[model samples]
Structures are given as C-alpha cells and as structure tokens.
Target: MATAAVAGALGLLWDWLWSERFWLPHNVSWADLERPGVGNFPRARHVLSAFPLAAGIFSVRLLFERFIAKPCAIHLGIQESVPHQAQPNAILEKVYTSITKCPDGKRLEGLSKQLDWDVRKIQGWFRHRRNQDKPPTLTKFCESMWRFTFYLCIFCYGIRFLWSSPWFWDTRQCWHNYPYQDFLIMFVHHLATIGLITFSYINNMVRVGTLVMCLHDSSDFLLEAAKLANYAKYQRLCDTLFVVFSVIFVITRLGIYPFWVLNTTLFESWEIIGPYSSWWLFNGLLLVLQVLHIVWSYLIAQIACKALVRGKVSKDDRSDVESSSEEEDVPTGNKKCPYDGSSSNGANQVNGHMRNNCWAEE
Candidate 1:
C-alpha cells in the first residue's frame, strides 16, 4: 500500500514537471507544436528511444570486448602478471575489506599482536593483497580499445552529420526556435552529460547539444589510443598521441567550446529567442560543463609539463590502476622482510620497495 502511494506521488510529480507552462514559452502551446502526420520535428517522446539504444550499445560493447579486444590483446602480447598472494587471515581480511587497506602504525601494532605476526610481514601482506585487486593489463588494454573505437566512430559520424547543415557554418542557427532540433553516446557514465542531453532533447536544443558532444568526442579517442599504445609498450607512439590529444583537447574544449559554442548558447541564443526560465537552466548546465573542461585542461597541462621534463610519457594518474605506497614482496618461507636478505637498513628496504613507476608502461 505504501509502495503504491509512493509510485502514485512520483507519477504526479513527473507529470507536473513536464507541464507545457513550465517548459514552453507563453506564445507556444502543445497543440500548436503537435503534428497530425509524419514530420521531421523532434518530440519529447523521442528521448525514450535512447534508453533501448543505450542498452543495445552496452550489449554490443560486451561482445566487442570479448571477441575483438581480447584477440587484439593476445596479438599485442599484453598478458596479466601474477602478483604474490597474501596468506588467508580472517582479522587481516576483515580489516582490508571493511576498515582500511593500509593500516596506520597504531592499527598495525594491534594487528601484529593479534595475528602473532611481524609488522613487516603485515605490510607485505597488505601490498600483495592490493595488487591482487588490480585488474590485469590485458583487461585495461581491452577497455581502452573499446572506448577508442566508440569515440572514433562517433566523432566521424558527428562530422558527416554536421557537414551540410546550416548550423555547422553559422553558430546563430542553433536558435531557430524560441526552438528546437535534433543528439551523443559517451554520456552513459557522466551524470552531468546525461542531464544536459536529456534537457537538450526535451527542449529541442539538440543542434547545440550535438555540437557539444562532437567537440568532446574529438579528443577522447586520442586519449584512449594513447593508453592502448602505452599498454602495448609503444612508448614513442604513446607520447606522440598524448601530445596530439593535449593540443586538440585545449583547442576544442578551452578555445573553441567557449568562444564559439558558449557564445551562441549564452549571448546569441538569448538575443535571438529572448530569455525564459528554461533558457537560464540550460545555460547553467553548459556553464557547469565548462568548469569541468577547465579543471581537466589544467591536469593535462601538468601531465604534459612533467612528460617534457622526464623526456618520456609519464604514468597517467587518472588511469584505472591506482598507485599504492606499499610494494614489498610477500615472503614465502621466512618471516623476515624482503630487505633483511640484502641489507640491515629497514629504511632502505622500504624506500626500495616504493615503486614510483606505474604498471601500465612497464
């Protein structure tokens, strides 16, 4: 009974949110916009079609990863490394999963006494356990390849679709109505992107939305390709692609998006259509996106500077593999730490185990 009542309330709320008065201008009505026969005009209902399309694309991605990307990984000689495993311990397992992967000195001291183990052994066990959780390099390669394929295809399609359109040349044509047009797939995980696309579709502001998607798609594939190259140990190729991606990312996201796209959406669109409540809401989302672009651009710049200084492509901090401070190898027989065999200095042993190099490049 409560579930039914909640559902009913939600249904009414959805209806109220999409009411004509809230979305459309005072001059336009749903009756005037509705078509009796087949027409090219975009409708609010058309956005529902994206749900099934998104699901289909996801299914296709799984197939592509297994069949295509897996074979490519084999051909490229990208194999998963077998890291040392941690011994089974209920107390340590509980702490690793629930409490913390890396226990502090106080926590470690308590755990050492509880387990009747040395502090170094506990540290090595945690290190090995963390490495176990990391997905193989082959898995990383396949994921990057899939994203690269998708982004490349979408960017090409965007170009083909926009080539002959009037709005391709004229930024002002995006505001044809007070109005609407007709689309992106890279928005699957990004909440902001999903919100923006849904808003654009409902408002018929698709022309500008498509442009925004294409602008982003332009550099995304390059980043993915660079990762694929890095995973395959093609250092020169990876560095080159990274440079190209950085340049294009800055050009498209920072230079073109704001100066051209935002100019039209904010100043030109307002001048053309006049301001409504939806207009402010739409531009606000676009601004939020712009803020993200700026933040990413700064990170890219830092990476590029570091790469230049190193004279090679540095490890991508943003990649799936997270860095850990602990790298001491788990002992098989003796309880002594890895460094005990080589040297008596504990500090040198710890520092030696600290691998600054990332897994992907190696």
Candidate 2:
C-alpha cells in the first residue's frame, strides 16, 4: 500500500514538472510524440525522468530497515538475555557482565562502577557470553534522516497537487483550469507525493516501535543495576522517566487523536459546511499537530541523552576499579602495603580497603 502511494505520488510529480510552464524548457507536450516533430524524444525523456524517482524509493527503503527494524532487534536481543529466575547477587553479576560485554560496553562500565561491582567479572561476562547486536550506526541514522527529508519534499509536491484539484479549486472560488497537460502534471505530482508520504509514515511507525522497545530493554537493565547497587531511588526515577517518555512517543507517533479529530471535522463539514472551509480548518489543525510533534521529538531526544550519560558514567567507574586492582597486583617485593605496616598484611589490607571504599561510595 505504501509503495503504491509513493509510486502514485512520484508519477504525479513527474507529470507536473513536465507539463508546467517553467524555467526548464516549458510547453513540452506529451501528446506531441504521435505527431512526429523534429525534436521528439518524449519516450526517452520520460524514461530518463523516472530514474530519480526510483532511486528515491530505494533510498527510503534502505533507511527504514536501518533505523527501525535493526534498532528493534537490538532492544529485543538485550531483553531476551535477562535471567528471570536468578538470585539477586547472580542477577547483579549477570547484569554487570552483560553491560560490559554488550555493544554499549561503555554504558555498562559506567553502570558497574556506579553500582560498585568488580570490573574483572564484568569483563569476564563480556568475554564468555555474546551480546545481542549493536544498534544502527550514525551513518544509518543519517540515512534515515535523509530519507525522511526526501519524503517531506515529496509530500510538499503532493500538497501542491491536492491543492490544485478541481474539487478544491472550485470550492475555493479559485481559477479552474483542467487542461489535459496540466491535469496530467497534477496527477503525476500527487502520485509521487502520496508514494513518498506512505513510505515515510510506515517507516516512522517502525521507528516509534523500535524506540519503545529500547525504552523497555533499558528499564530492565536499570532495574537490575539498581538492585545490585541498592539505589532504589535512582532506579525508580529512571523507570518513571522511561515509561512516561515511551508513552508520549507512542501516542504522538500513532496520532490517534488527530486522526479522530480530523475525521470528525471532515464529516461535519461535508454534511453541512462547505469543502473549502472544511479543508482550511483541517489544514490549520494539521499545522498545529506538526508543531506539537516536533516538540515531542525534542523531549524524547533530551530524555535519551540523559539516560545514555547516566549509564556511561556508571560504567566508567567500574573500569576505574579494575585498573586500580591491576595496579595493586604489580609486585612491589618487600614493599609495605600502602594502608598498613607488614608488607603481606599491608598489601591485603590495601586491596580490601580499596574494594570496601569503592563499594561504600556507592
């Protein structure tokens, strides 16, 4: 369905560009091909114009797979790895280990240190167990952005086609010129825009799903980390934030309310009000919704950044401990332990003190 919409939109755009009188060789007639003119390469030009449309479709598909499908898989993989019936201590160990070994290894390290865990054990977990996959790379993210932008451009073209429709024009008391060439132009442009918007909307839905999954998976990790650290406060805070943002993300993306509102308004307008007035009101509401959507997106970004930073800090502290321990083990033969007198006892005391102090800080 999305493909068909996009194809239709692209076709409309192609016709519009060709038929509309503009800077680029205006008044080119598609019907003129049968007349055998001196400069007749209509078929060739038409075929050539399609290349960009085809490329645009392909690019959008590639991006959808990257940002949406792949991220969801990563989140699910992490969620599946959590042990359900494990001991609290065992769960902690597993959580810590998984954090270190997972693709978001830095975050795990920060989390371990924040929770006061043995970094070596975390490293061991990473070495012995495989993590789910990594999230999509920045390149993929950029690609997705580009694809969405392309869709937006196409959607604008669709707006132009829809705006010029006879139904709209007549109602608006605007000029109603439906010449064959112009009609063909409008039709092709509308087709392209519809196709692009359809593709974009589906991809956006997938992205929303992926984000929800990530929030879910992150919550589980935080819960286990909180348990290990006995920092119930932080855990609760994170959980609340995640849940709230996740809900917001899902609601805005699904656009359930806007759809209903639009439907209601359109129905009322069709029955009693005129088409022009109905369309104007609908467009106004759409603009408002678009603004709200942008604001929601910004909020989501802020929350995600906060979570990532918190996780990274915790992991970094864990790595610091492992480094300190390795330093202590370096043989300083006959040297007194830094914390006590007798060399052997001193070394043991120093190591113990280091571990205790680290855990106490947590």
Candidate 3:
C-alpha cells in the first residue's frame, strides 16, 4: 500500500512537471501544438519509444561485439593474457571500493600496520587488484570497435537527415521549435544528453535536439577509431588518428558548438521567443554540456602536450596503472592491455595506465 501510494504521488508529480502551462508558451497550448494541420509534433507518449529502442540497441551491441568485434580483434592479433589476481582481503576490498582506488601514503601506512604487511606488498596487491578489474585488451578492442561502428553509422545518418534541414544551415530555425566510470564522465555525459533530448522532445523542440545530436556524433567515432588503432599496437596510426580526433573534437565541441549551437539557443532564441521557465532549464542543461566540453578539452590538451614532448601518444591519461611486472611475465606480441601505454618498441604493453578515449554524447 505504501509502495502504491508513493508511486501514485510520483506519477502525479510527473504529470505536474509536464503540465502544458510550465512547458509551453502562454500564447500556445498543447492542443494547438498537436493539431494535425499545423505540424508533426512530438508528444509525451512518443518518448516512451525510447524504452524499446534502448533494449534493441543493447541487444545489437552484444551481437555486434560477439560476432563482428571479436573476429576483428583476433584478426588484428589483439590477445588477452591472464592478469595476476590480488589475494582476498576484506579490509583492502572495502577501502578500494568505498574509498580511493589508490590509497594515499598515510592511508597506506595505516593499512600496512593494520594488516601487518609491508607497504610495498600492499602497493603490489593494489596493483594486482586494479588489473583484476581492468577489462582485457581484447574486450577493450571489441568495445571500441562497436562504438566506432555505431557512431560512424549514426553520424552518416544524421548528416543525411540534416542535409536538407533548414536549421543545418541556419541555426535560428530551431527557435521555432521552442526546445565514462573510469567511465564516470562519460556516464554523466550520457545522462545529461538523455535529459536534454527528453526535455526537448517533450517541448516539441526536435529541430534543435537533432542538431545537438549531430554535432556530438560528428567527433565521437574518430576517438573510438584512435583507440582501436592504439589497441592494435599501430603506434604511428594511433598517434596520427589521435591527433586528428583531437583536432576535430576541439573544432566541433569547443568551437562550433558554442559559437553556432549555443549562440542560437542562448542569444537568438531569447531574442525571438523570450524566456520562460522551461527555456531556462533547457539552456542550463546546454551550459552543463558545454562545461563538460571544456573539461575534456583541457584533458585532451594535456595529452597532446605529452605526445608532443614524447613524440607519440603513449598512454591514456585517464587509465589506472597496473603492475609493470605483469607485462614482463607475458611473451611479447601477445601482451595487450586495455588502456596500456605503448612501449618504445611499438608494442602495446600492459601494466600502464589506461587513457581517456571514450567520450559519448547524444
């Protein structure tokens, strides 16, 4: 009974949140927007389709990874070597999960004294523990391949659809519509994207929403492709593609996105339609996305600086380091680690930190 009551209250809240008075302009009504003679506008019910679509995408991803991605990884000679596992320790496990993955020196000293183990042993144990959780190199390759394929296809589709769109050329047309974990950043980005998309769709702002998606899809595939190259130990190719991806990322995300997309939404829309409650909320989300862009761009700049100094894109900055000894134990040519730094000899070595290669937007 309590559950039902809570659900009922939540349902009412949702309905209240989507009230036409809140979402639509005072001069416009939901009924007027939904008129068949006016325009084909999105309804609240239409957003329900995302559920099945999400399920279908998941299923497709599994099949694609299993069949296509796995085979490609094998063909490219990406192999999985067993990583040394950390011994079970309840205290350490709790600390790793609830606290920091990498313990500070002071915490390490405390843990060492409490566990009656040397600091070096504890550090080694943490390294092995980190490796245990890090996905296998083959797994990473397959994941990147799947993402590359999906993003590339979507980008092409977006372009095809937007080619004839008026808003593609003139961003002002969108005002008429009125709309990573280790992947943590990517995770937040996905959530933000979903929020923006859902909010825009509910407000019948599909034109601007589509533009946002296209702009994002434009640069994502390149990053995935670079990861694939890095995984395959194609050092030169990986470095080159990383450079290209960085350039495109900066141009689309930092340059075009703010100047073109945000300008239209922030300045042009306000000028044309003025502000409303929903309008402020929508723009606020866009600004959130822009802030993320700036954060990522700073990270990419650091990576580029390191690459320039070293003359190659060696490792992913976001990756956690595993034990260096692990790579020493594995035979060369078969030792591939996810997010592992490439060795000077052009072999992708395990036991290095994983880089931040996966960035998703919708």
User: Could you say which candidate leads in TM-score?
Assistant: 1
What lDDT score is found at residue 186 in candidate 2? 28
Better of 2 and 3 by lDDT: 3
Displacement of residue 171 (Cα, Å) in model 2 is: 9.2
TM-score of each: 0.81, 0.25, 0.77
Q: Rate the local accuracy (lDDT) of all candidates.
A: 0.68, 0.36, 0.69
Candidate 1 residue-wise lDDT at 217: 72
In terms of lDDT, model 2 sits at: 0.36
Instruction: Give one digit per residue, the lDDT tens place, for model 2 in 1-362.
Output: 99999999999998875442321112433354346544322232343445687677678668765677446434534222221122235655566465543335576678577767666454434433332222222332333234334434444544455454543322221212211112233223323333322221221211221222222222222222222221212344543444444454435433543453334334533443334422453345444544654564454444445445553112211111222334445554653333232112111122232222110100
- The predictions' CA RMSDs to the true structure, in order, are 8.4, 20.6, 7.7
Q: How many clashes does each candidate structure show, in the order listed? A: 0, 26, 7
Cα distance off (Å), candidate 3, residue 10: 8.7
Worst 10 residues of 1 by lDDT: 353-362
lDDT (C-alpha) at residue 88 in model 3: 95
Q: Which predicted model would earn the best lDDT?
A: 3
Q: Which stretches of candidate 1 lie over 4 Å from their true place?
A: 1-15, 178-193, 316-362
lDDT tens string, model 3, 1-362?
99999999999998897786779766777778667677555556755656676777889999999999999999999876677878999999999888646588899999999999988688777778887876777888888888789889877877887788787899887676453001111221233345566666667666766677778777777778878888888877887777777678779878998999899989988887787778888888888888877877776666665666787776543333456666556654586643443422121221111122222343
